[model samples]
Every structure is written in C-alpha cells, then in structure tokens.
Target chain A: MATPQLKQTPLNAAHRRMGARMVDFGGWDMPVQYPYGTIEEHLRTRTHAGLFDVSHMGEIDVRGRDAIAFVNRVTSNDASKLVDGQAQYSALTTPEGTVVDDLLVYRFAEDHLLLVVNASTTPKDWEWIRSHKQDEAVELKNMSAEYCQLALQGPDALRILQTLTDLPLSEIKYYHFREGAVDGVPSIVSRTGYTGEDGFEVYAAAERAEQLWDRILEAGRFGETDGVMPCGLAARNTLRLESAMALYGNDIDETTTLLEANLGWICKLGKGVFIGREALARQKEEGVKRRLVGFEVTERGIARDHQDVLVNGERVGQVTSGSPAPYLKKNIGLAYVPVEFAGAGQEIQIDVRGRAVGAQIVPTPFYKREKKQSAGSHQPSAKTQ
Target chain B: MANVPEDLHYSKDHEWLRVEGDVAVIGITDYAQNSLGDVVYVELPKPGEKFEAHESFGSVESVKAVSEIFTPVSGEVVEVNESLSDEPEKVNEDPYGAGWMIRMRMNNPGEVDSLLSSVEYEEFTSAETE
Candidate 1:
C-alpha cells in the first residue's frame, strides 16, 4: 500500500525556497526549522521578531444569534465575558472533562466568533461542536483553508507590524484584534501568539498568503528587527514549552482535566451549564489525582517526552514535554505527578531510557519577556502560567 | 550533501571510525550531527567498559530528540571525549575533529573489514535520505 501525501499549507513553497528542513507535523508537511537552526530561531523570537507560517492551524467560524451562547456551552472558559474585538484562550472538553482541543476564541461580533484550534484536531473539533449544538441556531463553518495565519513574534512585534498597517496597533490590547487591510489585503490582526513574547497574528485571505508572507518579512527588516528569522514548528514548540503553556495531545489530552493541567484559572466553575462543567466542578471539589509540574534535570541526561517520572523509586507520572531550553541554557520539561511531588524544589527522578536521572520540580515560564506598556487581558498576567 | 570522509570506516548507524594500529577513534558522521541538530549533551561509557559491535555505548541529545550511539566494532573503550561535557556544539561544528566521541582498542582487528568504505557509505546515505 502507498502512503498518503501530507497536507501542505499555502506557504509550503515559500518554506522550501528559504531552505527549510521540513517534517511531517500531525500529517501536515511543515517546516521544523531552517538552515539557521532551531536555537537561532528560538532566540531571535525572544530578542527580535521571528516570522512564522502558522497557516496549518485550523479555524472555524461560529455565527448566529446564539454564537456566544453556543461557544460558551462547548468551551470551558466563560466566553460570555468576551466583547467584540476580544479573544480568549479556552478548551473544548468532553463530558468526562478531558480536553477535545485547546483553542482561541475570537469574538468578531455579537453574533459571530472564530475558533482557532490545533491543525491535527480540526476535524474532530468541528464534529464535536456541531454535535453539541443541540438545536441551537448557530451556523458553524470550517474556515481552516480560507485564511492563512502569519505570526510576527518578539519584543519588536508592534514596531514592525505598525509599519504595514495604519491601524493603531498600540490601542489593541493583548487578546484584542482589529480587522484591517495589510499590504492591501483585508486581514484580522490579533495580539496573540503561542510564544510567550508579545506578538501579533495576521489572518489573511488564502490567495494573498505568499505575497503577505514576503511583505511581512520585508517589513520586519529594519534596524534592530532586521533579518527576522523564519522560524518553524520546532522553535515554536520550544518557545511555548518554556512558557509552561500546554500542548494539546501532549500535555493535556482526553484523559486530562483543566485542574490536572494547572489551568484552573480558565475553568470558571460557576459559569453555569456546559458540557464538562459538572465533571470539572466535581473534580475540583474532590481535588485532582495528579498535577502537572515543571522541572529541570539536575542530572547529566536530557529527559525526553513520555519518559517516566519517579518519586522514591515509585513510578508516579510521565513527562509530557521536555527539551534543552536554548535561551535558559538548561534542560527543562513538564510532567504530571502526584500532588505531593508537584511543588517547586521537590525532588524527583526521570527514567531516561531506563537510566534514572535526578531532576527537581521548578517554577515555570523559565523565560519571561519584560512586559511592555500594553498588558494582556483575558487571564491574570502571571508571567509564568 | 553530508561529508563522508574518504579515509574513514562507516557504520550503518552513521558512526565513522578512523583506525590506527589496533586502536580506533570513533565519532558520529557529519550527517548524523546535522540530522540530530545542535547536540546539547553526550553520555559516554567509561574507558574500561567493553562492548560488542552495534552495542549502544552512549547517547547524543539535541534540543529536539535523543539518539543512541552504537559502536561499529567490538572493543574496550580506552578513552572517552570529555570536552563534550561543556562544549557539545563541537559535535555540530567539527564533528570529525574536536567532536570525535570515543577511542577504543579493537578486540578483533579483522572486524574493520566488515565496515563500509566512504564511497559505499555515501551511497547508503543518499539512498536512506531519499
């Protein structure tokens, strides 16, 4: 039998032209890094701006008189608080309280919202949302292919992005967005990103992706932000992992809950009737079985994802994400363990390929960007979580 | 287009060996380092440890993944690269020189004849990558 070809985004050709080392990421042929390397790209995103082709991420539009209601019903976060032009990081959960997918809710208007989900979970998310509609008048449309997303992330994101649009980007607070024309193309510029740094995500028409990608790269070429690194998914993964942000299939899955993943801040238990609200609320009352914790390897080996975590020579949990953080200059990872071993400074061991390596639980967001004037909304500005 | 030096003996697992008398110096090929991407740490066996051919004697770790380093021929480790403890990037910069991983005394000198030559290794790499 022949293997099926991987899906390609609109920027596929552009990535190849730039000499990217491509990989298959969740069935999508995406660039994992360029010849410049993942470390360079990761650092550049923290110092200067890094342009990313996030077109493979899926987008679904929820429109109707009950759009906000429908979204609030399906997502764990209280979407009713989202005003026009605002966005929120939320998760769609199963009735059993495990995550279907973590997503971004963009409130376009009173009757319309855009849900940005992970690339691999798009089809599942769409079906879950439609099935939960339950006679609601919401119209759901999968717009994953209609728009291409380009993320310009770094401390200089605004300085570079301001040159392209006349819109007052400074006024748009974090988690806020504005519909404007970017390089003569209609676009939705959102002040959000997976990386911990301050950045903007541009959603543009699919046809204009190539030109817009080039134009954004060109615009970011000035003074301090010149030669913006064209980062790939590898850099993005490291960036997010350093921030202690959860990745869907890895950190939080169908078997995990918001409380277990340390995302209780987004679980609004009192938000009233939702798919997983009861289970989540009950779990909250009884306390979680285990809690996710960030750790640093005090030993020689690098702990990798799925490695077992041990406490007192007993297996407690497993690593969800792990890597040698480029900027921190240390090996770090996230793992789920019994609550007793989840505190900072707690001692633990990671079984790296059968060899026990000493590690210690530590406070996360190992790398935090100094905040600029505009503070992000939707969640408490706790630099790490 | 990874470098496969003409004088080195290559293993199917991407290790290169430079034999001198009965002692052989082993290092991962340029192709291996390039594929691994920015090796952050290397776990090497002790100098006295003995291993058979194709046995995992050490491990190489990068920011993305971890790979085991297998010995190309059966031998007793005589010396291990200690500089890599602080300068792991040497594996990426000069994989054939400062990045050489281990030195071992070959238990069976005749085993060298079984390893691939530079030309054969180059062809193998091309075919594997394709």
Candidate 2:
C-alpha cells in the first residue's frame, strides 16, 4: 500500500521559513520545535510570550433548533449553563462513560455551538458524534480545513495582543470570547489556552493564517522589545503538561472515563440523560478504582509515558504523561494509580526504564500563575507538584 | 551540512571516533545531535566498563525524547566525560569537541580501517536526511 501524504497546515511555509524542525505529527506535517529548541521555547512561554499554530485541531459546528439539546446529549459537560460568548472544556463521551475526545465547547448561542477537538481524533470524533444522531434537528458541519487557530500564551500575552485589535480584551474575561478583527483579519478571539497562563486563542480563516501569524508576531515585537517566540508542538505539549491539562490520547482515551481522569468537574452527570451518564453515574456512586494523579520524581531519573508504576516491585499502573518541567525546575508527570495511592503526599515508585525510582504524589496545577508579581522572580509561580 | 571532521572516523550509527595514540575518543556526530535537539540529560558508561564494536554505551535524553549512543570500536572505557551530567547541552553545542562522551583503550586498532571516512559519512547523512 502507498503511504498517505502528510497534511500541511496553512502556516506550513512560515514554519519552514523560520527554520522549524518539522515532524510527522498524526500524519500532519507539523513543526516539533524551532532552532532555539524545546526547552527555550517552553521557558519563553512561561516568562514572556509564545505563538502557537494549532490549525491542525478540528472544529465542528452544530446548528439547528435542537443544537443545545443535541450537544448536551452527546457531550459530558452542561452546555445549558454556557451563555453566549462563553466556552467550556468538555469531551465527546462514549456510551460506556469513556472519552471519545476531549474538546472545547464554544456556545455562540442556544442554537449554535462550535466544538474544537483534538487534531488526530477529528475524523473519529465526527463519526462518533454522528453515530449518536438519531432523529434530531442537529446538523454537524466539519469545518476543520476552513479555519486556522493560533494561541498567544504567557504572562504578557494580553499586553501584546491588545495592540492588534480593538476587541476590549480585558473585558473578555477568562473563558469568554468575542468576534472581532485582529490586525484587520476577521477572527474569533477567545481567552482560552492550553497553557495555564493569561492568554488568548484566535480563530481565523485559513487563507489569512499567514497574515494573522506575521501580524501577531509583529505585535509581540510591538517596539521590537517584547518579541513573541514561535513555539512548536514539543513546547505545546510541555506547557500543557505543566498546567496538568489532560491530553487526548495520553491522559484520557476511549478506555478512560471522565471521572477516572480527574475531570469530574466537567461531568455534569445530573444534567438530564447524556451519552455516558448511565455508566458515569454508576461509577460515581461506586467510587473509582483508579485515578489520575500528578507527581514529581523524588529521585534522579525522569519518568516518561507508558512506564510502569510499581509498589514494592509489583506493577500497579502506568504513567500517562511525563516530562522535565523546565519552568518548575523538576521532573514531573501524571499517572493512573490505584485509589489507595492517589492522594497527595502519597509515595509511589516509577519504573524509569527498568529502574524503580522513588516518586511522590502531589497536588496538581504544577505551575500556577501568581496573582501578584513581586520585584524579582525567584519563586514567582506556585508549584504544587 | 553537518560538520564531519576530515580526520575523524565514523560509524553507520552516527558516532564519530578520533584516535590519539592507543586511546580512541568517541562521541555522536553533528547530524545526530541536531536531530536529537535540546539535550537535557546524558547517561554515560563509567570508566573501566567494557564493550564490543557497535555496542550500546550510553543514552542521551533531549527535551522531548531519548536516544541511544553507540560505540564504534571495541575497547575498555579509559575515561568518561563527567561534565555532561550537569550540562548535556554541550552535546548539541559541541558534539565533536567538549561533548566527546568517552575515551577508550582500543581492543583492535585495525577496526578503524573498516569505519566510514568523513566524506563517506557526509554522503550517508545527506541521504539519510532526505
């Protein structure tokens, strides 16, 4: 069989021009890092600002009279609570209460909503959401190709972005968005980001991706002082990992339920009958057997994904996501362990490439944005893990 | 183009070997470090450890992934670069110089004749990247 061609995002040429190292990410020709490297990009996002091309992520528009009803029926979150211009992180749930794909539900109104899903799971999510459609007035349109999304993230992201558009950015609170023009390019400016920073995500037409990208970078460079670094998928992953955000395939999958993934906050199990309510509600009442827990390596080695979690040399669970957090200055990771070993301050062992290394379960949000900035940055952020 | 020093001998696995009298210095090639990206941690074999030709000696961890470094010739490790534990980025910055991983007393000095020359390794790397 012939190998399928890798799909390129609209900003592919710009990435190449910037000397980005490209890799095959889920069959998409995506930049993994720039010449400066992932560690530098990761630190740049934490300290200053970083621009990310997230055009590969899929977007599906749900329209019709039953849009609200259809969305609430198919997803795990309470869409009825989302007002106009409000967005919530949610997931397309399976009948078995597992996640088909974790997504962001942007409610334009009661009759129109846009679901942004993981790039690799876009096709699968579409088929799954469609399979659940049994005589509803809902119309699902896959609009993945027509749009390009960029996330401007960091502590100074707002100051840089404010120069681009007259969107009244500060008025757009956390998790709120507005439709406006960014540097004359039409966009949906949402104050939502994967990195746990005060940032914004812009969704614009695919044809204008390059224009919007260059303008944002320019705005970040406003005076050629606060330049926004172009980051890649590697930095994107590390930033999200530090935030303790659940990655689609790694942190949560078809076999992992919302409650088990520590995403019970998004699970409005009481909101009528949904796709996964039955199984999820049952699990809630019975209590979860295993849970997703954040941890730090107490010893020397770094614990990575798929490595075993051991207790007295006996295998228990596995690490779902792990990395050396450049900002936190320590090795951190997430894993699914038995409930007995999931609490904060609990001790566990990580099989780091066959070496049973010591680890400590810790509270999440490994790096939290400080409410106030001091004179110096000795320990400006709150690190729970 | 990757910097393949004319005097160094290379293995197909991208390790470059520099001989000094009976002692042989070994490290990854420029192409290898460039592909690895942002070295964070390096695991090196201790002095006195022995290995055969084309054997795995140590591992290098970058920000995103881990890769193994192979030894080009058989020998006992005479010295290992200890500075790498604190500063592995040297592997990416100076893979052929300060980044040299280990020094070995050669088991068979004649093995150098079978290794790829600088020009041959350059061609091999160009084809591999393509």
Candidate 3:
C-alpha cells in the first residue's frame, strides 16, 4: 500500500516562487490560488487580464490518411465541417449515448488533428479512440508530455498578447487558431478560452514553457491593459462555473447523455454514421428526460456541490457545481432535473446541510462579456458548455 | 505564520478566547482566517442564544469554503460584533481584534484553564500544518 505520486506541470516552480497556494487537483499538484486570493484573481480576470497555466490538459495528435474519418466516428461533432485552422467543441460519447469525455478538436489539415482532452480523463479517452480505429491508416500519438498550454484571458487579453507575437491576432476569429511564434517560441495560438471573456490559448513545447510564461508575464506588466495577474485553479473553476460551463465529473458524466447535459448542439446525427449516433438520435426524438439547468441562490446560503436539490419538499436532483460568483456578486450553481422543472425562473430549493435554501433556475451563462468590449466588435460567440 | 497572542486561550478548532471577568470574547484564530482565504460572509447566532461546549454557533463563508465556528465553553451569548455583517474582510485583516465574533457570559470559568495555552496552541497548529 503506497500513495501514488502527484504529477506536476512545467510551471510548478514558477507558481511556487509566486507564493501560490498549491493543492492536489485531479491527481495533479497544482496551484489553487496565489496570495491575491480566489476572489481577487477572479475579479482581475473579469476586469483586466489573467494568465493561467493550463498545461495539465492532455493533447493527443491524430494523423494519417484516415484521421478525419476516425475523428468523425468517435466525436459527436462533425469533423468534416471543420476547415483548416478551425477548432470544435465535441464529446466522445459511449455506445449508450453517455459521455466519455468532452474535448476540443483542432483540425490542422485533413490528415492531421489535435484533440485536447481533460487531464483526468485523457488515458480513458485515448484508449477508447485507439480501440475503435477502423484501420491502421489512422495513427494516434499521445503528445501530452511534449506540450504545455497557457490561457491569457479577459477583456485585456488581446492587448497583452499583441506585445509578444507579430501575427495579426485581430484577424483570428473565435474558435480558430494558427501556427505561429509567440515571444520567439514556436507555438500554436488559438483564439479560444474557458473563461467567458475574449482571450488566446498558447500551446508550446514543454521545455520552453517556463520561458514563454515569463516572457508573457514580463510583456503584460503595466501596459495599456494594466497588466495581467497570475490566476490559479480556484479562479479558473469559479470563472468557468459562472459561465455555466459543464465540468466533466460534475455537470456531466458516464450516467448522463450529451442531450441531457444540454449539449445537443454538438451532436450532429444527420452527418452520416458514427458511434452512438443511433442512441443519440433516439434520445433526441424521445426528448431528454432530465435537463441540466443553471440556478442562482436567492436565499442567504451558499449552495455546494453534491448538495440535494428539492422542489416542493421532494428531492429532484443534486447540485453539480456551485460557487460565489465574484463579478456577479451572487451564489450560483448548476443542476439536473426533470424537463418540466428546467425553464428559467422555475422555483427550486437547494438543501444546504439540513435547511432548504431558496433558489431559482436562470438562463445561462450567468455572465457574458458585452460584445462591444470584445475583439472585432462581433457578436459574442457562444460556448458548447 | 499567524500571530497567536500569549494572553488568550485556544481551541483545537482554531478559535481564540479572551476572558474579562465573567464575559469571554471569542473569534477565530489568525491561522484559521489565513487558511480560509477571503472572508465574504459571516453568520452569527442571536444575542441571547445559549450553547454548550464545542457546539457550533455559526459559520464563516470564504471564497473557497465554509467553516463552522464552535463555542469553546458553554455560555449565553451576550453580544455579537454587528459590524462584521457589512465588513467580513475584517476577519482577514484583524482576526483577534476588530474581528471578534461574540461576547458570552461564561457558565464555568474553570473551563478556561483546560483549554490550550497560546504556546501549546501554536505548536498544535504548526504540527497540523506540517
């Protein structure tokens, strides 16, 4: 009987030097927050910009003559619709129509693609894909160890990032990416982020991760965007929760289908045949039984994850993720219940401890960045979560 | 490292108590506040509520989690720090001073001698953290 070792990202030393409060997150030793605290770090991301070391996410490279077909067979989203330089939010669903994992697919070309999966579920996702390959024409490589990622997110992200890269970032649309050099380091710059704000995600070699992190921080110090703050996992969790994004283990899991998680938009059933297509199609036609809904605590208590949700004194569901939204100054959470009780403004109660705390279903995302303030002044792009 | 005053008695749960005659002032230790992060809300019991030793009086909510504050000795609450409702950050700023939570009329003064001394409490917290 022995305790397994926790994995550390390349930026672990940097986070320690900055006095970040470290914690074990999903078997990875990562920083939960810096001395600035989660509330301040959260607010900093909303108002200015925040730098996040998201290197723990797994990256798998899919390449070969049948890469496109293989990806199309595994993921719920249509891979054929993704042009070069485009990224799609998709789910790896089981034959039962339940989610295996939600992942981001980056299409570099017809024969080459990148799948970024959750750190905790990477091994499972990789095995599921490898076992289902139709032929040897598709090759899979686990590149998680070769790369590290950084998310520069918020209203000021573009300004901070422009100082390091010579590429025309303004032309890159949301959910799109380009192969370029950032701070003299070869990297893939994607106009994607988990925070509900405008931002870019930079993926670089693991060896160069520390240098790229330092250079990005140095360039962002005291400029037009008023600098960027180093945010940790706690802030990242709160930010994503406020945006009503689904956390794999929490909001959706093996027992929940993609449609039940309210992510049917990514499930393209009519695009030929794929794994789980028949089950998902049947579910869609039969309609979802229980729907995940966003909720705001109306009473004087903070709802917590795993707490029971009651409707008129009967248990309906349980909270998936709950937190005090710093920018919104409200306590919000997500839960799943019967479709009859899923509409916005529907009354519900979250049993915090023994007492029932008043709550109500609200339309997600709880917070949205004004379109005029984001890049290109285009309409705010919606997330699959 | 948190500041633990030498004149106060402490509980294993990280609460500090200062005795002034029959009335005892209580607040969470600095170590507790530091571990809890930014204190956003405080839920306190009514002024006349009575409690037994080690009973939970209320909870303090931080950005990360909620922790219950316990009574170190059985007593009737005489007064509560009302200002904390509007300014919960005071708990993080001065956990032993302006952030004092409640004043209670002690039912057994001898219970103070049984609580951990400041030196013992410091050693306990340091050992727990290590």
The TM-score values for the models, in the order shown, are 0.97, 0.96, 0.96
Worst 10 residues of 1 chain A by lDDT: A376-385
Query: For residues A251-357, what per-residue lDDT tens digits would candidate 3 score against the true structure?
Result: 88889998888888888998877888999999999998888889999998889899999999999998999888988999999988888888889999999879899
Q: Which pairs of residues have clashing backbones in candidate 1?
A: none
| DockQ, prediction 3 | 0.74
Q: lDDT for every model?
A: 0.89, 0.89, 0.89
Q: What is residue B58's positional error in candidate 3, in angstroms? A: 1.6
lDDT of 2 by residue, A332-352 (tens): 999998998888998889998
User: Candidate 2 chain A, which ten residues in sequence have the lowest lDDT sum?
Assistant: A375-384
Q: What is the lDDT of residue B99 in candidate 1?
A: 100
Best by DockQ: 2
Interface RMSD (one decimal) of model 2? 0.7
Q: Candidate 3 regions off by >4 Å?
A: A222-225, A373-385
Model 1 docking tier (incorrect/acceptable/medium/high): medium
- Deviating ranges (above 4 Å) for candidate 2: A222-226, A372-385
Cα-lDDT of candidate 3: 0.89
Candidate 1 residue spans exceeding 4 A from truth: A222-226, A378-385
Residue A73 in candidate 2, Cα distance off native in Å: 0.5
Tens digits of per-residue lDDT, candidate 2, B4-27, equal 899999999999999999889999
